[model samples]
Target chain A: MEKSAGSVGKVVVDNISKSYDVGRLKEPVLDRCCLTLPAGQLTVLIGPSGCGKSTLINILAGYEKPDSGSITIDGAPVGGPSSDRLVVFQETALFPWMTTFENIVYGPTVQRERLRDEIEKDAAGLLETVGLREFRNKYPSQLSGGMQRRAELARAMINQPRLMLLDEPFRGLDAMTRELMQEYFLRLYEDKGQTSLFVTSEIDEAIFLADTLLLMSARPGRVIKSMPITLPRPRVPSMLTSTEYLRYKEEALDILHEEALKAFEGGSQAAADFVEAYEERETVG
Target chain B: MSLGATSTNAASNKSIPGQQVGEDWLYRAQRALTTPMPYLGIAGIAMFILFWYLTTEYFKLPRFVKLPGPVEVWTEFTNPDPIYGTSMYTFDYYKHIAWSSLRVMLAFALATGLGVPLGLYMGWKKKFKDYVFPIIEVLRPIPVLAWVPLAILMMPGREAPIIFLAFLAAFFATTLNAMLGVESIDESYFRASQCLGSTPWNVFKRVVVPGALPDIFTGLQIGVGVAWFSLVAAEMVSGEHGLGFLIWDSYVLSQYPVIVIAMVTLGLVGYVYSLLIRIVGRSLMRWTQKGQA
Candidate 1:
């Protein structure tokens, strides 16, 4: 659980491209997107609403296959869902019929038999950590939105995956709950040292949770920038009020704003130009 | 953390006052009484019987066509020889009741055992549904009574019509409900199961079966009621010893008391069967009471 630094557990995306047949013609959603996720760190992917941040997460989680290119996790070629890579979707994916305790223990019970007792113990402790031990016997419908999301997080972490994929995990929470959840995540991440890929539209969340931020263009999503956070952890709620956090937040917002305007005005043409520029820059560098 | 602590403290303080305990008890009692209609229905039946007794006995109507009092019925129930049979000294009313109950039980059990699994399969798999659903739809509109001629032609014996009628009554209802249950399952649930290294068989066993249980139980309840109705019709046509047969036989013999008793027994048996099915359903779906869905 000791925290490690740098690009130790590298994720290689080899010219990944994805397209959907939305109309009669196939429309490209993500075009030749290539990026490396650094090891033992939280990397945030930020973009506008329809910029395919979720698609990238789904591809990484093996929920959807890209039309072209390959993604390698650790060193193996990603084929399908595995215990090593776990996804906490934007939606609360907790089984409605299951109690909170059952949801948390599900992954562990499904994956490893020898670790059953240990997993149950760990699941109980996680419920306490998420402040849901009292509600453990309650079903998902009994919990509030925040509590459901917390249970989902605990469920995802129970399996102890090498790479955690969070797709807008705190999107619908109130402002206060969202801040508390971010702090809880930082604490858990510090304790576990799991590499994570987090997708979000919020600039402040990206700055707060990520060790390295990967800014993406609007559509046919390609990484526009990759900036490492100089801010130290454990990142507390007070860090949001810090001047350094504000500076990083401003930088992410500026990039997002320009992309949003271009997306609004030029549409697919702007996206094509952005991808061309991104590819050109990659070639030159 | 501060916000959560404040809310928890507020909730704990509210619990200590015990202000709502008496009111809560009263509310719960009222809710329990009103939630199930059968409790209220018993009171209604008592009132109706009281009115019947007063109108017939106290008002003193003509003896020939006078409303038969509950006392008379009670007397007839205890000593059935004069009222229930052609002979003045002998009547075997219990024999008819036993035979009727046996036929209903046999037919209902046969229908449920056959209908449920077939319904589950039709609902679960698309390929099975595509082939089977059309056939079910085609057969569904035809009433169980309408199948009497077909049953007579197709089946070898008299018992076959009775069983066939019960099966026809239940089959469509169970199948349709099972299909709805399967269709209504959350797609994400299946996806999640598949993603977690679950094979198709494991997914069906763990997720699909449990998810569809509530709907399936609902179908079973409806099926039982339908089966009882169909059993009555079947007995009316060709039964040798059943409540329906007793009613028809008593009518032919002009024994009005026996006919009324047979009708009452038929009603009571159907009501009891329905109540039993509901109890079974409620117990099986006890988790739903905890608000799982």
Candidate 2:
């Protein structure tokens, strides 16, 4: 295991801005969004729909470039995609033609940095870790939606990337499956302590999984608030009901509620839902 | 019957909604035989044959007066001493089948060999597509039969001209479909490949080829059918020993029953070619098959 120091995984996004030209109009998505993913920590980015969370992840993964401003990982300027930063896409991008084991072994085999036997051995362990050992021979289409996601995780993990970018990785899963996946993900993250940026829309999911929760403003998005969760390690379901957890949730909700109203004025549906959720929480509390 | 075989082969080794796992081919064949669809198809063919029989033999209608009855055609096709000098017992019947089949196979092979690579390159590179696509677009709309005269003029031998016509028909279909196949692949797959440390060449090898296979096979299927269609047309126009020539020669001799036999032979051979392509497609694309159970 090529174990580097924890400091090696720091990622810095400095004054990044991106926009798409929609016919005659220029649609600004990310407006000088700046944030840092500290080494050996999971940072959760939550915001309203169309808030450019995915765009940030895309830029971090080096799939797309920012209009102006730069991104760096551990002081080195990031260019195109490399094995150092692996992204688990929201829609499960496992190659349909390749089996689960084959997808997991793809990075090492293609890069040719590891021995063939060594790559296979590590891939086998990753498959086991992700609980997809039984489905090693199954293609992406053959696996269920959740199984496919797990297979993708294993595929990315085998590369031992310094930073992991998850673009709403558990978005479409059913409630029960989504909860289970979150726990499963936290377990893996705790074991490796790799720098991870998790982008999501769900408030509970953002609160439960993140070491630091960074909430962004509505479109032309930029990080508006960064709150560190002081809850103890090996977080449990019991923590959800704890006073400290509620305190943090309340603090986060207050900031998000203000931003949601700004978004609601601009005709955003997700912002309306957030306001509604905040009002319901206030009445109940 | 050939339609039933093709469908069954496509549905084979697949766990479709209504199909049972571990079911043998014989059992499926039995099911096909007993199905309402097959019965309806048989009845339809029987009705067509009955209409032909009534018009030519029973009614002796004025419009069908020149055409031979089903019985006469059948008898002539099966006879050891055919008056038309072409029958199941004659070596010339087999020779015609061989010539047509060989020419179509060669043309299809050549088209696939050249067209697939050309299309893949065109799809992969924007500059390559810009340089080549306009010529193909202009050439493709011109019918394969329209090239028959030019093909004969360009090529020296009878075989070359017929093969050239067939090749042109298959090439356009194959190349266009393969190009569309590459375009059909999702943008995310390419992004995923690049993120996983694949080089430009590896991306082409790993992402482009397999991702485009289903469409490539579709192209192959359409191409093979067109190859047969153009081969027959080419043979009919030029000097040849193929089934197309056999049909024309029988007509010139007024061996009307022999002409019907040749048409039937052509239909059977074309169906077999499509069935072969479908079977190969199924075998190569096991990943496309749904749940194993």
Best by DockQ: 2
Put down candidate 1 lDDT per residue, A49-76, tens digits, no spaces: 6788889988987889999998987788
In the range A52-100, model 2's lDDT, one tens digit per residue, is: 9998998898878999998989999998888899999999888887777
User: Model 2 chain A, poorest ten-residue lDDT window?
Assistant: A1-10
Evaluate residue B91 in candidate 2 and report its C-alpha lDDT on the 0 to 100 scale: 99
Across residues B1-293, which tens digit of lDDT does each residue of candidate 2 receive?
A: 12222233344335444445435445644553355357788899899999999999999999898998999999998899998898999999999999999999999999999998888888888899999999999999999888878898999987899999999999998998889988888988898888899888888888888788888889999999999888888888995699989888888989899889999899889877877787667555667878841
At residue B70, candidate 2 shows an lDDT of 95
- Top TM-score hit: 2
On residues B157-248, what C-alpha lDDT tens digit does candidate 1 reach at each position? 88878777877887777778877887788877776665655566656665666678788778877887788778778878878877777778
* Candidate 1 chain B minimal-lDDT segment of 10 residues: B1-10
Model 2 stretches astray by more than 4 angstroms: A1-7, A23-25, B1-37
What DockQ does each listed candidate score? 0.21, 0.47
Chain B TM-scores per candidate, in order, are 0.76, 0.86
